[model samples]
Target: MADYLDFVGDPGRDDVEGWLYPTDAHLMSVVNDLQVDRGFRGDVLEIGAYKGKSAILLGFFPEAGESLTVCDIFDSGAPVSDGNARENTAFYPGLLQTDFEKNYLRFHDRLPRVHVGPSEELGEIVAPGSCRLVHIDGGHTYEVARADMETARRALGPAGIVVVDDWSSAHIPGVAMALWERYLTGELIPLAFTKGKFYATWDPAGLTAGEVADAVATRPGIEASGTVRLGRYAAAGVTMTPGDWQRYNAGLRAVYSKLYADGGASAPQRVGF
Candidate 1:
């Protein structure tokens, strides 16, 4: 986190900004920092790309040879027949409106390869053991998230980094819990856990999620409310067990409930396995 780089506007800045999609600042910071620090030489992938906000951020990295892949259904509300589609569109209506093709072309040469389909269908598109960084922002439901994580894991290389969003949101927690109960419990040590983000580095050595919980518990100012920056570009190590993840989730739920009771937003629906 020491060497921080300020984001500079690219040619497509204005056009990409007009879209309705919102990119996570923390994630943006993480990507930029990684590129600045790591100099992105490996492939980049994002599970849920809405109008390519993150894709654009990924493009900003000064990585010359890296290939960027974007996966999305691109149905818009037009095929909003299912309850899930309806709900998805309710939150994001411009899925179809935003000219993804044209908007993507804003990057012109840097435009990433867009995989048009569901996560499962698009999973195999990315070759196994080829990616250096994978961002999971696709379906919030558990099953979808789990599948997406599996796909990302397949594509991820030994030193690859996996970033999962909506850690605090209920809908996304299914994926969160599954990863915790499984890998976090067994090994796959957590590198960092932000307020609403879970970052785990793939390590052969089995590290428990409790180890991560312990790390968080000892952070300088985490006891205070709101998301605290646990680690900058530097990786923060954590370990946790199955029991630890459960207890952590319970504590998070309680905290979230209190926040909502005070008129704050409730956590998003957790992904269902």
Candidate 2:
């Protein structure tokens, strides 16, 4: 199967629009690819499909029998809170459902199941224990984010992965608060965390934290910086900002060039993600 990077091209050269970082993109692909390789088949869900940058990547990894679903309140005035409404206005000004659909169709022949409303509706729309991966990136308020986290728990199967965006952003302390509350008392087991997202699981029966960290280590440009202690437990920590990504790309180019020069046409140009 073709990887998302194959469709999008070199991250440093062919750039796509939206907020998805290159490091995050690589990690997302690795998570899904690992599940697919292990013969695990299930639905995929994204709580926030902001212009389909990440959604397009999610769409690429679902196998034939699997499905993908995305939910967002695009231009609908459907946000449940004033803070969430303000977030939409400030961060997603003039956004429309068509904006996401247009960008999505550029890469995928069809769009995933789209639910245009608050992320709260996802628990009712998406069946419980059905999804393998649930990306919770909707509202940033503590109320909305906590609701989304609960929705993710209900929507995931055993060992299913849950990724929460802006889990610890300084400005979005609510998300961090909600995240820690769940991590401390809830069943969401921590797997890993990057700069912008936190990865966890509903159950370790299907996938362990160690396994996730191992998979992340295999992804390009991501450096494992030991673990983050959560009480008695610990979660893997990874680091790679935009500057690090640029340096990683430069290093890759240098290696590829050296390989070609040393082995002529026999050296591989590039491998799929």
Highest TM-score, which number?
A: 2
> What does candidate 2's lDDT look like per residue over 99-176, in tens digits?
899988878898899999988777777988888898888889999888988888888885688888888679889999
TM-score for all models, in order of appearance? 0.61, 0.83
Per-residue lDDT over 1-273 for candidate 1, one digit per residue giving the tens place of the 0 to 100 score: 111111211111233432111123333344345434544346878887776655666555435676778877776322322544755766656566256666666655546787777778765578887777788877776677777778877887755667787766664466676565546444454556544566776644322233333444543223212233332323343333345335445654665566589677745332111
For candidate 1, give the lDDT of residue 74: 75
Candidate 2 backbone collisions, by pair? none
Candidates' lDDT values, in order?
Answer: 0.55, 0.77
lDDT of 1 at 61: 46
